[model samples]
Target: MQTDSKWGIYEPEKACPNDWDLFQSYCYYFSVDESNWTDSKSSCQNQESMLAEVVSTEQLAFLTTKAGEYGSKFYFLGGSDIVTEGEWIWTTSRTNFTVTNWTPSAPSDDKGKENCLEMRKGAGYQWNDVHCDKNKTYICQRPLL
Candidate 1:
């Protein structure tokens, strides 16, 4: 079976490369300290990356857990409503991934006129909708080989 140790991820042997290869998949992790929804998305694009598009169940769990390490310091994910209300989709793609990390009763309406998606560092770092103007840290990622 593929092992997390092989990539020095389980124990984090050191400051691993931003582009970490795991289970035949390349994972690049980047973060922005703070930015508005649009700005955050733009930043990732400028970096040739987009707000992380988590593709698998394991990947979503891993990312959500890691986000909690920051403790109440919310962070944005790749999902947004830049196109239309109630049409939440990952910034990297048009359709939502099969696995989602949103908490129960979350994303309640486009209330607060939220145009952004941020993670709440609790209960497995689940997701919550927030105003696009709210400042918070964010993650951006891209596949690498």
Candidate 2:
């Protein structure tokens, strides 16, 4: 077991890198800078992480709460449908969504150009699909070593 002054006790496998936040068995990094979805994904890759793959309702809630604390209006996540329209998948994990919290009437794929996923402020911090090229802050995640 390991002890963190602020977060209390955790197992060695739940240890996180400096400046990252630990939730469950994962470590998350909420970026301070903004970038397009592709660039954001690459950025996370460079950090030995991946754009956050929100796999559960609890995870989504945790992420959104952290986003609120970060005060960012939007944040890119790992979901996209660029390869197959309307078939969203976490780009890094290559896994289809088993849990979702999309805002009502969202992901309308407005103008057939919205393909990247974001947690949006206007949507009460719910998921929304937007253009992949749009720049936004991002969240990255990796399993704790």
Candidate 3:
């Protein structure tokens, strides 16, 4: 049986649209353009996807590596605590964060205004909370249909 070094059991690759990369059962799109959290989310929706949600350590590692390849300083994720401070959730799934890779001393909700999740280069590609209005590149993902 074929196996992926990182993911163990390998799954068959599915066709992803141009500029999208297939991983497991999903297609991921790494955007070059920058936009705020809300705009990024809308952009993904327009593309029939949602902001990339990192649900596991492996998923987070995949995204962090991809971000480096994309050469982006920061990328908006699907997580946000805008509705309730300190309670981050994946906006699309509306589920609480079960696995997180936050950088030490991060998600501080700096000045009580940082509510959006971002993978930041300065944070070693770990998760951090920043102002939702801050423009940044983003990643999007959708299931293989």
Candidate 4:
């Protein structure tokens, strides 16, 4: 539980790929659901949590797989730059990502509209710019103690 803070750029750990199977306390939600990203974030909040925040490759893999298990192609993470565009950071513990999964030429401050990120289907763990109002389910991670 060594959560560190950065100026703005989140510095996620190297990797923490998951070993998902049948039994696990993993959490997941929709990436491109009917609900907008904001709504999706709200949904997660209603559950007492916001969008998910993957700290390592293993956690990332677990989350991605959990989404797949729940029949979601992609899901919204707790990370975003809505308030501070270009300064995306996780909402939980302020954990940051050092290895971004954005696709080539992504996260562009397009006309100052796009502020959220979504995991692309069939794109491993890469993300793309998306609207916050767009409806989608977000995953929430509750690591075991």
**lDDT by residue (tens digit), candidate 1, 1-145:** 3348667554323332554323325454546368887788888788776777767887876776666644547878888776888777876788764667777977776554876788777646777788888877777776553
Ranking, TM-score, top scorer first: 2, 3, 1, 4
Question: Model 4: which ten-residue window has the lowest total lDDT?
Answer: 14-23
lDDT of 3 by residue, 24-143 (tens): 888999999999999999999999999998887788778888888887999999999988878889999999998898999888988889999999887778889999898999999999
Clashing pairs in 1: none
Report the Cα lDDT for residue 106, model 1: 72
**lDDT for model 3, on a 0 to 1 scale?**
0.90
Error of 1 at 24 (Å): 5.5
lDDT of 4 at 51: 72
Could you give the C-alpha RMSD of every candidate to the true structure, in order shown? 7.1, 5.1, 6.6, 11.2
Pick the winner on lDDT between candidates 1 and 4: 1
Indicate which candidate wins on TM-score. Answer: 2
lDDT of 2 by residue, 1-145 (tens): 6667687867464479998999999999999999999999999999999999988889988998999998899999999999999999999889999999899988899877999999998777899999999999999999888
Global fold similarity of model 4 (TM-score): 0.67
